[model samples]
Target: MNDVMWKRSLALFAVALLLVLGGCGQLTNSSSTASTGTTSNRKVQTTGNYSTTGYNSVVTEGHYKTSAARGVAADYANNALDVKGMETGLMQLSQDVFSPNKYTFQEGQYISAANVKNWLGRKSKSNATGLNPEANGSTDPDKRVPEYLGTMVEQDYMTGSGSKLSLGGISIALGMNAVDYYQKEQYGATFQTKVNKDKQLQEGKTMAQEIVDRLRAKNNVGNVPIFVTIYSLAEQDSLVSGSFIAKATATGKTIDKWDSVDQQSGVLPTVNNQKPINSADATAFNNFKTQVQNFFPNLSGVTASVHYLDGALTQMTVNIQTQFYGQTEIMSFTNYVASVANKLLPGNAPIQIIVSSVNTTQALITRNSGEKEFTTNVLQNY
Candidate 1:
């Protein structure tokens, strides 16, 4: 099936599943608390930057057990607090982000009731109570497998007081598939919905408030600023703010307030003055897109967005959608786009390229400094 047809079919199937499994109870998981330790033995240290030691300890102590959860937690702990005009000297308070990596069936896939039961049985061996809490003596056909993910916390250290004030942020991950299911059931909504419902915002606020209460009680810190981030894991795993659902900030004893996740933007470090995308840059990018279309006639779409900091281009994200014949085709197309983007963009800034087909998603982070990170995941086979 074509991409458009595949998406429609998935939506229909989700609606059917919801109808068949209506009135199911929400999934929940037990929280396991791990103590936030001192940084005396930490190998890395920076005076004003976010605490690398604290982040590493969170991972090392098994606060975040899954790779996906840890990846999300680390991204927030490292980059969320250092926005362009934000204050410095904030330390990640705790690394425990959240619980429950809920199971989600990807698009273009279906499971028989027997198979789901078998899968749950296998998952139970790893966790004492099984991954799906609803599976205990329940015959719900649409049960969810919720496993503990991880957590991340950031705080500000008070100078000359030897006390760390809470001034950073915390992020929790809600499995994307679970979120998709809930959104459909709650509002019959699609992913294209620009604004989240008030109910969703309230849920985020409650989560943030709970985190603040726990942190304050644990560290005896006074009222300080905190940003609570909620990440929804999609096919492409990245901490780009756009991929998140809600980002809320709170201070003192006040309740956490939610902001528009759709209006979020990101800035790269090292650039001093932020600048808009100039006509020349846009023309160059358009020319490159034309070249890509000519070379890869099967490509469905190509687009790019530039990120600036202090009047200098610091990063650009290029997204491409096409049907790939195989892994080789996907890699070749991605590398070619990376090369084109590198030449089109100025300076030593990084470029993130995302290529998506019907059942596969691949991403590449490339820079003029010769640094690269690539990841590819095939959700299904044609």
Candidate 2:
């Protein structure tokens, strides 16, 4: 297809993300049709910045362990970016220990939705598996134990090629609440309890060990390496997603050590310099925005999210908003934006530029990591 007529495809398969957020219902295993001692060898294809090894394709699917949790991510997460960031960041962290080159990927099979529901609940007599502290009879939301732990998502990595793949490692991400929103009464105004970084990390450490132990009790899960990551979710009104604060690896029944993760994400063109930002990235985005806005005077706004890992720029997703309706205007603006992105944006990290009108996406520009040339696609309106 020609550049202007090219229709961009979905960027990431998000198998893990779908499974967690879609309320992975009852699922059938591929082993049902495979011969004994071996499963299928098919590796599901995917696009975007990262790739998976192989996966056990599902025959039939059902709800997420807890259907309520799916909405929790949608309603509680700061925005779509935070939801995507939480899922993608978890996989990236898993790749550090369970090399994607060596291990196959699978949606979590051991931790059921039921397990997650219980673990997310308040410690009470009716439900013994609750992980959150029991609620205190305090009028204040702060005095009552905050539902610090939001959701638990698991991804399994396997070894052995051909048909005989076995679980080698498991990675779990615990989404914690940065701000706890609650109501004093049934119809009362919502109250917010800010969870500091120290509190979030401390609660995450304790929960991580307990979750690791719970998984260890499962069949065929003992002795395998398990990686747990703690993600602090952004507040309801925040534009950017919260970041992963810490991670840990568990071998036996216990988690021996924890490591600090220096990863974070922020929106471009800081609001009154409220949040810290990388000056170089900020400058480049500003220049790119200025050029595109200047070229297309009818543009609405241009914004972006810059992601950093270990203090180095890793990725960026820039969004361009326009009011133009004609295909020619969109095509022209898309090409110009792509040119500006090529000249001014950071070359070391992968970057995605999305141009859209009020209702739909108009074009997509993507540059892979370490590559200079950008692939552009302008969507057709039909």
Candidate 3:
């Protein structure tokens, strides 16, 4: 071939090689493997951002060995949320926050048996029992499994507390807090009706201690710590107001006044117990993102905030904000807080849960629909 012809062929060959290389490496506008970028693995998380963890609720049916067991469950469900029982803490939080009622009783009206079944899940034929004392009145469960119904996902705050005694016999676990005779009289307040809040407080602690003692005697939960926390609105509100509950009761009697401790917000220790469960939980949550950063490094930021009440470490919580890509997801401030909170409590270990995304909520639905949405709240008054 002539020198000129060879030169022309070499130039064309060089141009073809450049085109092939460019096509393989390009990410945009190319129909090749390199162009198909991954969005899942490339999520850039940011703090204070939310991605909407869907609007999912859960209903759990729990069983108790005896009446006293109910009290132990009661405290764990409410005020003493600091206790590290996965079932008691998260489930109670769900019910308390999003309560579901069986039926709406009008002024001067009584609830029907049919309506009661739909509300508390008591087989319409059999007397409504074991669902919720506050829901189905006079229908006490006799060692039967109570049915459970609710949103898809739920949390389990496991405990070594009084598992044997409380989780011993079949004490149907229905998380329905319908307003009934006892519920109407008192509710979650310390001095509901005439019940002395201080005395009731002692009863709960005593019940928990007794229940734990029985569990230990029976060799049920082993060395697992069972911290029972009974709820009385007055006591919790007082703690939030910088006051410590010296003592409270539920027997329709007055309680000793508690002075506010405005300055200290669980900063200093109070309980002389072995480990600082509350403080440890707080610290764990604060540094949670750092712990998970290596696993999912595409993080942009975190979401949520924690609030410190007064004196007691029991009232302390840490709020986390997890941001990814452009989507903002808010799972549960209480969930993360309690998750870390459990780490600090006197339990065998922290709670375990399977978290997921829930994007849809009532607020995001059709605004013009002329329909009333069902509103419910679950309460624990053991």
lDDT of 2 by residue, 1-382 (tens): 2322111111121222233324432122422222223345443221111312123322112212222344444444544556667766887788888885566566677777677778888889988988888888775855767888876667777676435667799998888888888788999899877788899999989989999888888998868999999998877656667788899899888889899999978776666555656887888888888888777878667777788989988778777767787998888878888888899988878787777765677787888677778889998978
Candidate 2 lDDT (Cα, 0 to 1): 0.70
TM-score of 3: 0.22
User: Positional deviation of 17 in candidate 1, in angstroms?
Assistant: 30
Better structure of 2 and 3 per TM-score: 2
In the range 1-382, model 1's lDDT, one tens digit per residue, is: 3545434433332232233223221111223232343334432211221111122112223322222323333342222312211111111111222111211101101122232233223235554422223324422224432221112323322211112211133322221111322232556543322223443444445545654565455443455444455443322222232234455555665554555443223322112354424555556666777888888988756655454433455445555667666767776776776666656655455554556654445444344323443333333334
Superposed on all Cα atoms, the candidates' RMSDs to the truth, in angstroms, are 15.5, 7.5, 25.8
Distance from true position, residue 60, model 1, in Å? Answer: 9.1
Measured against the true structure, the TM-scores of the candidates, in listed sequence, are 0.37, 0.83, 0.22
By lDDT, the better pick of 1 and 3 is 1
Off by over 4 Å in 3: 1-196, 220-230, 233-306, 309-382
What overall lDDT goes with each candidate model?
Answer: 0.37, 0.70, 0.26
Q: Name the candidate that leads on lDDT.
A: 2
Model 2 vs. true fold: TM: 0.83
Error of 3 at 204 (Å): 1.5
Which order, best to worst by TM-score?
A: 2, 1, 3
